[model samples]
Target: MAARRKANRILAAVLVPLTLLTLAGMAMLWPSGSKDGISLANPYSAAPGVTFDTGKIQSVVEESCMQGSTAPGQSPDTGGQPAPAGSDCMFAFTEPDQGGSPVKVVVNPEVAQSHGVKPGDQIRYLNLSNAPGAAASQGSPAYIFVDFVRTLPIVILALLYALVVIAVARWRGLRALLGLVGAYFVLAGFMLPGLVEGKPPLLLALVGSTVIMIGVLYFAHGFSARTSTALLGTMFGLAITALLAAWATDAANLAGVGSHDATTLINTSANISISGVILCGLIISGLGVLNDVTITQSSAVWELYELAPGTSARKLFTSAMRIGRDHIASTVYTIAFAYAGAALPILIIVMLYDRPLGDTLTSAELSEEVIRTLVGSIGLVLAIPVTTLIAVLVVKATGVRTAGQSAVGVPDEDRRPHGTSGAGAINADDVDDTGALAAAAFERRSRQSTEGSADPATTRRGRRADRG
Candidate 1:
C-alpha cells in the first residue's frame, strides 16, 4: 500500500503537469482560421453552390407522379407541363427570408415518405439561377428541395435518450455523457484541425485519444485505484492497437482510398496520406470498446475482491477471469457483428459475384474490415486479462478497500439477486477466514516487496499482538 501510494504520487505529479503543458501547447499551435476551410482532407465540391433560401408553402398547385416517354403528362423537349396525379408537385410559397414574396418550386413525390412536406409547411430550399427549363433561365425562378426544419423532433429524440440514460444509470450516466462531450470537443477542436493542417495523423490521434481516455475514465468513474488500473490497461491496449494497425495497413497493402469520399479527398488535397489517416482511424475506432472492456474487467476484479476479501490474489484473479471470459464471448461477436452489419450492403453485392466464399472474404473491402476487426478484437481481448490482473494486485495490495463501495460499473441493483444486498451474496466457503487470509496475503506481499521473509518470532509476535 505504501509503495502503491508512492507510485501514484509520482505518476500524478508527472502526468498532471505534462497534460497541462500539452493542452497549452495545443492551444498555441493549432490554427484557428485557414483560407481553405476544414474538410475530410481538403474541400472537394460534392454539390455546386446554390442560393439557399427559406419559405413556407402557400398553395398546393399540382402533386403527381411522372411516367411513360414524358415526365408525368409533360414533354421535357417542349418544356415540362403538368404531370399525372401520382407524380411530383409544383407549389407556390411565401419567401419569408426574401421579403415575403411568393415563389414556386417542384417537390419530388418520391421523397414524400421521407420528407413529408405539404402545403403550409416551412422549409429551406436552394434557388437555382438556371434550372433545366429555358423558362427558368429566361425570367422565372426555380427552387430545389432542401430540408424541413424539424428541430422539435430532433430535440425530442435527444431528450428521450438523455432521460433514458439518466433514469437507468443516474449520476454515472450523466458523467459519462459529459465525458462524451469532452471527447467530441477534443476530436473536433484539436485533433481534426491538426490533421487538416497536415500534422502527423497517428501521433495526433494517439495523444488526443490518450487525453480522452484519461478524462473519460476519471470523470465517468471518478479517480480511484480501480479507474487508474483500467486506465493503465487502456493505454497499453491503445499502444498495441496502434502498432498492429500500422503493421496490418502496410502488410495488407491497404491504401484506404477506395471509397468515394476518400477518392475526393485525395483529389482535393494531394498532401494528406489516406492510408495514414485510415490507420489513425483504426486506432481511434477501438478506443471506446477497448475502454469499455478494460473498465468492466477492472470493476469485476474489484467486485470479486469485495465479495471475498479474504480470498487469495490468485483466486480473485481466476474468479475475475470467469467474468472476463463471458464478456469476451459477447464482445468479440459485438466487434465482428458490428463490422458485418456496416458492410452488409457490400457483402450482399459480393455474394452476387461468381467467386467462392474464401475469395469473396479476401477481397479488398472485406479484407480491410476483417483486419480491422481482428486488430481491435486482439487488443480488446488482451486488455481484459491485463486489466484484471492489475485490478487484483491493486485491490488486494493492502487488504483495504479503496472506495469502500461496490464496483463502479456494477450497479447496486445488479450486484446480487433481487431483495438481497449486503456487501454481496456469496458462499461463505469462498471467503474462508477473511481476516486471516488478508493477513497472510499481506505478509506474503510484504516479503516479496522487501525481497525477504519476516522472522518466525516476529510473525508470531505480530499475531499475538493482534489477538491481544
Candidate 2:
C-alpha cells in the first residue's frame, strides 16, 4: 500500500511539471495572433488567419402554400410566388462582415409577419449563416440552419455515453480521456504531419501506433505485467497485419480507389503521397482490434493464472486457448458486421444493379473492404494465441507464489523427507511412508475397537450357568 501511494506521488510530481512545461512550450510555439497557430480554415498553415464574429439572424421567414392548395394533385408551389414587394411578408436581421462591425441584414419578413410580428418587433434569430469577411464584435448572434435541430439528439447521446463511461469506469475512464487527448496530439502533431511530409506510411503507422498503444494501455491499465504482455502481443499482431496488407496491396494491384477527396488533397498539398495515405488507412483500420484482442487475451491469461497458479504451463496454455477461441469467434463476426454496417448503402446499390454476386464481390471497392475486414480479423485472431503463450511463459518463469501459500508453509519433514537419495536428503519413498502410516493408524484403531467390544457368546454362557 505504501509503495502504491509513493508511486502515485512520484507520478503526480513528475507529470505535473512535465505537463506544465509541455503547455508552456506549446504556448510559446503558438503564433501570437492565433491560439496554437491553427486556423479553422487553413489548419496546416504556419500563420493563422484572424478570427471574426458575425451577427446572428434575428428571425427566419418560411413560406408555404395555404390550406386551399392542399389538394393531392395540386403543384407544391401553387399558392406562393415569393414575397410581394412592400408587403410585411419578409424577415429582416443584422450581421457582421469581415474586418467590419455588425450591420443590419434584411431577410424576408413574410413568416415573421404571419406569426404576428410587425416592423418594429424584436425577434431572436434561430439560424443564420455568416457571410464572408465577417468582423468580430460583441452582442453578435450566430446563425445556424434549421437542420441544427438534428444535432440535439446526437449531443444528448454523446453526453449519456460519457456519463456512463465515467460512472462505470471511474478512474480508468479519466485515464481513457487523457489517452484520447494524447491520441489527438499524436495524430495531429505527429502522424498526419509526417504522412503529409511524404514519410513511409507503414513505418509511420507502426511508430505512431506503438506510441499510442504504450501511452493508452499504460495510462488506462497502469504499469503491469498484463499490460506489457498485451502490448507485446498487439505489436506482433499489428506486424502481421501490416505485412499482409502490404502484400495484398501489391498482389491485388490496388490503385487506392482515389475519390474527389483524395484528388483535392493532392491538389492542395504537394508533399503527400496518395498511395501512402491509403496504406496508412489500412494500418490504422486494424489497430483497434489488435489492441482489443491482445489485451483481452492477456487479461484472461492472468485471471486463469490467479485461479490455478500451481497449474503447469501446458495446462495454462490449453485453458487460455479456450478463451482465445471464443474471442476469435466473436471478434471476427464483429469486424465483418462493422464493415457491413458502414457499407450497407454500397451493398444496396450493388444489389439494385442486379450484378452477379461473384463480380460484385470481386469489385475493387468491395475487395478493399473485404481485405480490411479479413486482415483485421486475422490480426485479432492471431493476437490471442501470442498473448496467451507469452503470458503463460512469463507467469511460469516468474515463479510468483499463490495466495494460498501465505498462510501455511510446507512441513519441514516433508520438505526434506528421509529417502534413498545421494545428494538431497528427501526422496519419494518418504512421502509414500507418510501416506502409508496415516492409513495404517486408521486401520489399527478400527481393529482395536472391534476386539474390545463384549462377546455375545460369553454373555450367553453366563446366563446358562445362572439358570442351572
Largest TM-score belongs to which candidate?
A: 1
Could you tell me which 10 consecutive residues in candidate 1 have the lowest summed lDDT? 64-73
**Candidate 1 per-residue C-alpha lDDT over 379-444 given as tens digits, one digit per residue, 9 for 90 to 100:** 999888988887777766645334443322233223233334565543323544445334443543
lDDT score, residue 260, model 1?
A: 76
lDDT of 2 by residue, 1-468 (tens): 333343345444544464455455444333223133222355322223333233444443433312111222333342346535443323233333333433333332344344433333333333223334333422232332121113557789978987888899999987887897898887777678777666667777766776777788889888766777787788788788888888877776665553556666666566667777767777788777788888888888766654434446776687678778888998898889989999897788778889898888778657778878877887778778988998777666555344433101222232232331245643222322323333433443454465447597985785598578
RMSD of each: 10.2, 14.6
lDDT score for residue 423 of model 1: 59
- Candidate 2 regions off by >4 Å? 1-155, 400-468
- Top candidate on lDDT is 1
Model 2 residue 179 lDDT score: 92
Clash counts for the predictions, in order: 6, 21
Whole-model lDDT per candidate: 0.69, 0.60
